[model samples]
Target chain A: MTPKKVTTTSGSVTGAASSFSWSKADTIRTSVAGVIVLGLLFWAYLLSSNTETGGRASFSLLIGLALGIVFERGRFCFFCIFRDSIESRKNNGFLSVITALAVGAIGYAIVFGMYLPDTSGEYLPPGAHIGPTSWVLAIAALAFGFGMALSGACISGHLYRIGQGSLRAIPALIGALIGFGLGFITWNTLYLRAIQEAPTLWLPHYIGYAGSLAVTLAALGVIAYYLLKSNTESAPEKVSGLAVLRSKFSPATTGALVGVIGTIAYMRIEPLGVTRQLSAISRKEFEKQSLLPETINGLDTLAGCVGIVTETISNNGWLVIGFVLASFAGALSANRFKFEIPTIRNSSTALFGGVLMGWGSMTALGCTVGVLLSSTQAFAISGWVFFLFAFLGVYLGIKAKVHTL
Target chain B: MSTKKISRVVALVASVALLSSITTAPSQAIPKNDTQTLVSADWLAKNINDPKIVVLEVSAEEGLYERGHINGAIKVSWTKELVDPVNRNILSQASFQKLARKAGIDNDSTVVFYGDNNNWFAAWGAWVFNIYGLNDVRLLNGGRTKWEKDGRPLTTAVSAPALGDVVAKKADASLRAFLPEVLKVAKKQQNTALVDIRSADEFSGKIFAAPGFQELAIRAGHIPGAINIPWKTAINADGTFKSTAEVRKIYANLGIDGKKPIIVYCRIGERASHTWFLLSQVLGYDVKVYDGSWTEYGNSVGVPISNPAGTVWGIA
Candidate 1:
């Protein structure tokens, strides 16, 4: 039997039919992307018009837009990045993370020097993502990493993926809500037992900015070097001009952009975090149902995305909204937007994994973006601790072939 | 029946109108029976069941009221309820009236304010209540700490009393000082005394704010020429106010006599309200709290600042 032939728009010979009808699909998608951009602009205008949270929310939305574009174009998913390194021994994606840490650390050092010139003083930089270092943090990171492996994405990864029409993310997010409730339930005992007494070590506090920056850069340099040495993949071919918008950004480029965005975000608004709004929404719901403890037991005093029960959408909520919408636009422009139907197996696993990630993030006070990325940039030892344990958890989960489940 | 009869009627009407006017005028004096500014916990305990007494627990601590509050006390969040939800100002007169009525605060009610954290926020509540011209607002002397330490009764029960008919007056400008008024004192152009009621570190520009506080200023320092009298100086270790004579002496040593109009301030005016209460209510001095305190003064552009710590942003 002869195989059927597909015709092109120009009536030329073809094989392997296009995913969808090609004649108007591209134009429709491009138009939709344009409309999304317009929508974002209108949303920003409305946010800025609000008297209470105008400037802050607007700024956050812009930052979120930048982050969304970078994350989508670079495919900056922690789960995928770790999986490549652990399962296939491809270390290129991991290099981007190191690059981001290095760039962000430098930026943070400059900002910190300006904010708190004398690091010898007991004062910490305001709004920096510095949290107490404890066993609980380590355990939380491990769970988070394992969940990433299980659910196929981290919290941020799931958020961005939702923009690409990943249906499984919906259940996972719902599961995360339940997970946050559980975290609140267990917070009091854990806080009193360990987090209360834990040491919040800022590297600059001990060694000064010069020494801290040197240490951070040197460590990142070593990691980058190791990643380059082990990486088997060749560098991607360079693309320029208008094509750049449609093409995937190089990992280094993505990292550098993310670092710049993060620094600007920290300078203007709060630290780069995605889970604060999610956690807050969950917390508010739980409080309404009388599920949360009357007090969160020193949670407010500690930093890193403390969830407050509020009726109005916070600046962080605006940031998340911008992130999702901009990611959708990016996906659409790249022709990567596809509505993936959720299978029973994928849905169940995603939900379970999301629950673990949510519990882990809530207990740790942040996720990869908040803790590992933002905290490390600020030279908090907690960030490095989280990085190590989270990597280990991913490695173990991948070795166990949890992703197949 | 003409001019003489009309004159006689006019004279009678004038005398009656005069008598009514004299009788109906509002008195400025506090009733002789309730003159105390600082009420003892014992006094509150005895009057806990008094329908005319409304106790308000104003706390900065989250969920503190739910955990336990003084019996018959209503919870008031210093951050949420006392201030405007949108603007950086006190609650509007209309909003204050609604909150007051909801809390069963009648015009004649003797409102006693207390809270955790050494009664810093409770004093702020008292100041806000005073701003709306509540006549008989009082502070619990030792606040929650002393009460808890003395093993006084606390309950988780919430009261839902009948709505009150309290009418809120226009916010009294005399009780609250604004930035322009404070700037005059800071620039030393005005003869008023500026009392900075923050920790020594904060006053010295060594730290922006008290540790763990969310509110902050861009620059670190106190207003130029402001006297540093930490609010805690007026309180004993037991969280009760020092005797009036001692407090007077403490201020007198700093050259702040009742003669000069004093403006008290802290990071966000809560601690300053504590000092405001001490100076105006207890010591019977002319004082006002600059609600826009260090957070305002430090952040304001081109404002004169004194940083003896040699702290400059980005300069080591």
Candidate 2:
């Protein structure tokens, strides 16, 4: 876990500066810190909320933190991992994401079954899919895939990288926001035919959580075997772009940790949805009267049309925000805070990207994290569709050579 | 060579000093009044009763306007009142004149707009007003629900003001989308993609909810050869648009030839208008939203139609 020193060349800055670089010892320490932070939050939630599910709450945060630490350390981002495979034909990162995803799906299925009280308990929140396929889902997945390539990151990356202060991450964030807004504007149409028409492919419905878990684990096993034996190879690095951020962290370690986070995210919150966190921000905006609610809600009701939404721990906004701050603290304590203003292209990308993301997230009903990871884990077909199309979109975007801005 | 060195040194010094001055000017400078375009509920809460201002509630629902609205605010039906049925795009100048007159809107009035949801339709109405040379209109960020949530002010009575004298200025053709213009873009084809920004069903002309829903059914499919890139795809789940990268992804998925023009459209044009804002104004696409959209083309006698989701529609 020794941190690898990296050299970066910035037009505006001189010397080989590293951001988020931590020694192996530093990573382990920060991960321990992550555990402590999660524990403290769990304690606070237990004390504050007068709910009987305190144990579940505590476990969820603990697992989520472990996952976050692993993810941060390994850089288990769908966009980055997926892009490595496509652009450079590097299979290691791609296989890592697939492996984590398989592990998560199976792990959640087993956990849900072992823990579920009954059939009704198996019912997941609206975008939390275990796998259902629909045209809308397909389109969204492809689009998400495309987004990852173009932006060079996914929703999760944008969220965590805020701590690293990567200027390009800002544009990516903005793009996500704008995508959500536009999604809201066009919700009515997508909902009526595409979203509504698509069948929910919930695992619990057919085989129960236990059976689903078994199948998921089996699938993961198969995938891991296939990936491990494949002829795919990692690209030779002239210099690691992430080397600066690689303190006690390496992509592999972070990837595995993210798997843990994904699991905890499911157990605690409804699921690990990065897009919904963004959605909550929009909802708050509507509530604040910054944007119109009824129109926005009615336009993209599928995205915003949560009927009888729980105001409890089901909301991931608090957790996402808390995790981000904790990440900042972790990087700072490790002496890995690189807070450089991004190049002009990077800044514009953030602004414009945020705006586009706001629009797209609204129309698509979720982002990569929200629909792709969370819902895919839940076995929703649409979730898969979103992931696939978004991936395609990202690929096309990258291929087209669109400037960052 | 010495002269060149002196110039470089002087340029370096001047640039440093200028950068320092700009950077040191303000870390938290409060923007001026004009700089603040969106006024929050707190601002409207305090200024609701101001004599110089007028509030208007524009919605499709009828009795809801009567049931509850900001006090002294007038009601305008976005579908019926704000737009001309024939054009189904921008309101006719003559119709706008009448509606403005009925709402007691003077050219100089500082009109604030809000509605049930964050004033989306209302904002659209306000935008129309602004485009028509009305500068005093502003959207109440978070709109009616926020106001009601905060218990700001409400009245069950709808205002009936004495009609004001508002004259008709010809429709700003520059601010509108017409068939001729669309046809021109359509002919260009690859350089231009018609974005039927309606729902996937509307674009595919499938899953009709009601029979004889003429407005909903005009021509059931999308434009003869346009891409069904709904405006909604631009936003996130929480009702905000996706970020710029997300947007490019959305468009790129739709096979949006960025080098070409993208024209977005919907049933009446309100939703498409938002897309127009995102694409042309925000993403900087050479984009135009078809304000007339389905309402006009679908109902048109000669326009074509399709059914059963054959072409690329929905998220793909």
Candidate 3:
């Protein structure tokens, strides 16, 4: 009897009459993806065995892997999320950010309680992303937001997108390097003028942890309410097992997972930040070329993603590596990997946007993930300021149609 | 005949002994110079390759030594390596001996200590080494900051020299002042100079500790009768110790003429170690570092404190 061929959504052809039949190309792709994933795991194992930074590096890598998968599966790009809400009036992605903030804030409260039981403004939790609230931070966040709109992605967005064969990420990252150098050059002046005496206010210090959590959740609820009200799309149908793995995850599920990952990352290694290693590399190169000031004037003492010049790969560096590779693996497995040749216009725009982002992140002491997500979770007032100004910047950029330019 | 021979021999022996005493007196009277306690960055750069000179980088900041340090320098953690982690005390004699031997320090080795943060921890390391009675211990003048500022070469290469056969002496009590002795001075029972080596804000009870520091006292103030002299005052902009005359004059202006027994302290003893180096090592004064410092003293119950700012714990 002749067998009928059936094409599956996963790009696999199955024989109807036969008990089990799969496409050879699909089988090869799946196998290669599995091998790549296993190789990444082995690399993480090697990193774990390092004597100096083994434990933290390993934890960071694993967290990055989880983040990569979530970012890919959930489409958790900051620019895309904002763009969806602004341009298309889709609020699911925006709601995801709200959910993430809510979940992460609770997780941070629990951790903060354990680390620093007394939040009476006397002591801050060690290694938390609490930065000074100042005009410089406002300007930085606005620039960063505009960069996100123009470049088609935030710093972390560019990172995960690179996995999906985005060639423009190269110029963007290179531009970021130059931007960081410039940031270093101008750091002393900005720091002395604005950031030197800025207040680093923590919500828990004033209202206690419970009150802070309530306020945070209430704020998130308000945002989620507006988002759901604006969303016109119908609810997605539920899928199970293998189909679930192949399909996009719901915003709620994605946000929950991201929150859990962030909490775990903080508990084990450090707060979620994608810019430390990048900034460190830039700072080191600038110092070598005599482009930076002798002293960065209180840069090292301030909290946030303070990058120190180092020859060895830091935990954050390992995290970035894992994020990129695991994202690549996820893309390959989902059949989403497609190499796009970069046009000159796109490349130049990406580079310019990346420069603004890099400079903004440096001046502000962190990017979206570091400042907005982590700092807000920690209940630092700086995070809220960044959030407000960044949204405004993106709104303005979208109105100006900079993304198209 | 016997009496005449004995008398003549006695006279000759007395003359020879007097001549030997005259010969050694001038050498003994010549005081120790700056080179004995401090080595310039230029001097270290020139002699960095010397085997007898064991360079040690003692930093409170993490990953600094691994990032880049003076070539062939040994990394020493001020928190972990220098102190007893379990007990709030300096490392045990056996542990210090082990550390010294592991770092290839010998009895005759010229140990040059340098570190980040203006050599605050490096001077602490020097103080610890002094307690253990290590001979030929010197601090790197200007430390890591000066070396980097001068565009000196740094390497990420870590040195692992052969094990040394050095032994650490029992900790010298004279070099370290405990709370009891400090209390006596605070109570005016002892005529001692108490130098509070913390910032003016800290000394005046305006703040419990410096920003970003976790270790702090519940009560914000300083010991009674202690004078506020920030440790940074002893160092130049380049992080090197000021000239002996300048340092002495600075202290003399504050009525600390090194005549009385001196006890120097800061928040965690590290900054005080810098001042301790200036007073005890450089100026040749009888000084002891109160290693327990404000963390211990201010936390102690019923201790006399002078809080000029009138700050209260958990209130403001």
The positional error of residue A285 in candidate 3, measured at the CA in angstroms, is 1.2
Between 1 and 2, whose lDDT is larger? 1
Cα deviation at B289, candidate 2, in Å, is 54
Evaluate candidate 2 by giving its C-alpha RMSD to the native, one decimal: 25.1
lDDT of 3 at B155: 76
In terms of DockQ, which candidate is strongest? 3
How much does each candidate deviate from the true structure in C-alpha RMSD? 23.2, 25.1, 19.5
Q: Model 2, range A269-372, lDDT digits (tens) per residue?
A: 45665565566555554545654334432332233212222355434544565556556555654555577677776666555545544555555556666666
Runs off by more than 4 Å, candidate 3: A1-22, B1-316
TM-score for chain A as predicted in candidate 2? 0.71
lDDT of 3 by residue, B181-297 (tens): 999999999999999988899999999998757546898989999998898888887788888889899999987888988999998899899888888888888999999999999
Q: Compared to the true structure, candidate 3 yields what TM-score? A: 0.59
Tens digits of lDDT, candidate 3, A191-227:
8898998998899989999999999888878777777
lDDT agreement of model 3 with the native:
0.82
lDDT for each residue of candidate 1 in B1-316, tens digit (9 for 90 to 100) = 6654564466447545555434322222464223377989987886666566789998775545655679888877777788997999999999899999988887877888999899999999999998998888899999998997788988756776567789999999888899998888877789998999899998998877687665468789899999999998999989999988888898999888889899999998989999999999888888999999989989999889998886876565
Q: List TM-scores for all candidates, in order.
A: 0.58, 0.45, 0.59
Better of 2 and 3 by TM-score: 3
Better of 1 and 3 by TM-score: 3
> What TM-score between 0 and 1 does chain B of candidate 3 receive?
0.88
